[model samples]
Target: MNQSSTPQVPFWAHLLCGWPLFLVAVGGAVGGGLGGLAYGISISIFKTNVPMPVKIIAPVFIGMAAVVLYFVIAVAIFTAIQ
Candidate 1:
């Protein structure tokens, strides 16, 4: 096989500097928003009386991390399965 002269870019580099960031950002936003709302609702239902801002923010951060970080992994798994 003939090797190409051009160097290949790393996945991390692409993630940081290329199109993947967009996917991550979108995923993070959507996930974070829904997570926040869900958390707030659950808390209200439980009647724990936690502050709304705190409850929402904490879950938002977690949800953002979950969806944002998983986008790439999901794609990798999909490719591997194929």
Candidate 2:
């Protein structure tokens, strides 16, 4: 039996760098998932009592943040690599 040692990959490194389209797609999926989760939690507790603005804004912001994060991370990684 032979044993080899290698450091485990960090979560941030694993996620933040990849093919451009794939990264963006991942961001969209993650954003959608987060938005759904937030909605579920909010409705469960608030039961339509949550304000109209809050419901509409939360998902939009989360989605936008995911897109921005994808670009920012890609640029940062590209700069660091070069």
Candidate 3:
């Protein structure tokens, strides 16, 4: 018995080549997951241990960063596959 030699598909091949709508959903999930994680960590960790000014500003900045991160990651994934 013999087997034909074909290059193995990369693990991410489907992710990079699947339906466009599916990719968008995946990207949004990943970005939202990470962004929410970051925000949660910031709120939990910096809630009470920080100085007054830091307490007021850190969460806001972290939240903004999370939003930016979400958008950036989503855009990057969508663009990369394009």
Candidate 4:
């Protein structure tokens, strides 16, 4: 019996291999952002003291940050697996 070693691919290859996972991460970010935005808008509309613009903007920033964090985490996990 003969066995050959598996080929070593680049980091980008690893990322591509995990594309579905990446998509999930993106979905999570979008869902979180939309939820936060909705909550913020609701609060702004219903509450008297809070500013509407801040409410709308903060969630967008948070959402972008969350997406970045998700990518970092996904890369870390992929690296660990490798």
Top candidate on TM-score is 3
For candidate 3, the TM-score is 0.52
Question: Which runs of model 3 end up more than 4 angstroms from their true locations?
Answer: 1-28
The per-residue C-alpha lDDT of model 2 at residue 54 equals 67
Model 4 per-residue lDDT tens digits across residues 1-82: 7655543334543332222333343557544554445444433333344465754455445445545765677688779999
Q: Which candidate number maximizes lDDT?
A: 3
Looking at model 2, the pairs that clash are: none
Model 2 agreement with the true structure over 1-82: per-residue lDDT tens digits:
8654533434432222211234324556654454445444433333344575764455445445545765676688779999
Predicted candidate 3 versus true structure: per-residue lDDT over 26-64, tens digit per residue: 456765565556555555544345575774556556655
lDDT for each of the candidates? 0.47, 0.46, 0.53, 0.48
Candidate 3 weakest ten by summed lDDT:
14-23
- Model 1 scores worst on lDDT over the 10 consecutive residues at 13-22
- Poorest 10 consecutive residues by lDDT, candidate 2: 12-21
Q: Name model 1 segments beyond 4 Å from true.
A: 1-47
* 3 or 4, greater by lDDT: 3
Cα TM-score per model: 0.31, 0.41, 0.52, 0.44
Model 4 Cα displacement at 65 (Å)? 1.0
Tens-digit per-residue lDDT, 1-82, candidate 1:
9987644544543322222233334546644454454444433433434564664454445445545546656687679999
